[model samples]
Target: MSEVPLPSLEVDVPPEGLSIGETARATGLSVDTLRYYERAGLLLDPAPRDGGGRRRYGSADLAWIAGLVMLRETGMGIGDVRRMAELSRTAGTEASRLAVLEQHRERVLADLARTRAHLAALDAKISSYRHAVAEKENA
Candidate 1:
């Protein structure tokens, strides 16, 4: 089967900035999630408001939120993401951030190796079954 391309999560700069709904669409997150980020302090700061006092999301904000989504979806706990956000807010925290990410990367690579091993075992079993079926057909 041909692989279907997934939509890009990359946020383009909107000169006027994006409204909450537009930000949700661009990031594939719900408005509720965006609001939760505000309440949870997961972002750099609560997204700034526009002239009318509605939340206006800048491109930078969208990019940051997308990263948060990636981290959380990649099995990072909310608390860890919060810690990383705090680190980002301070200066000279690069090494801490790298350590956190390096740890997560190691976990991911280990999981990948385990999954590949399982897949190989399953493939071998499937080949054995196919050969058995072929022999029965010949008989």
Candidate 2:
């Protein structure tokens, strides 16, 4: 199978901070979900504010949120993701970060193995069904 390239880091640079509405439009996420992520402690830094004090998100903020979205898609728990975010706040050391990632990686590997096994079983069942259907049609 052809390898799919990972998303580029270019999204990491947001020049002019975007309002919540603009960010929602850019990321294809809802404003309510953005607020929910903030409330859930999934965001690394507090979103900045415009002159009028409305929440504004920059490229770095979007990058971090995209990472959170990836973790969620991978079936990571919100609480664990929050813990990872807390670890990220201390940028110097990466031991804690590595530990968290290693643990999650193990979990993901195990889940993937199980999913593949289930898929194999389903394929076998499907083959059996097809054989039975063929026999019925021949009769």
Best by TM-score: 2
Report the lDDT tens digits of candidate 2 across residue range 17-126. 77898777767789999999898878988898778889988777877877887778888898889998898887654778778879999999999999999999999999
Tell me each candidate's RMSD, in Å, in order.
Answer: 7.0, 5.2
- Candidate 1 lDDT: 0.82
lDDT of 1 at 97: 82
Candidate 2 vs. true structure, TM-score? 0.85
List model 1 lDDT by residue over 1-139, tens digit each. Answer: 2321222366676777899998988888899999998888798778889789999988678768878888877788888888888887887887898898898888779978999999999999999999999999999
Could you give me the TM-score of model 1 versus the true structure?
Answer: 0.79
Model 1, 6: alpha-carbon shift in Å? 19
The parts of candidate 2 lying over 4 Å away from their true place are 1-14
The TM-scores, one per candidate, come to: 0.79, 0.85
- What is the clash count for each candidate, in the order shown? 0, 1
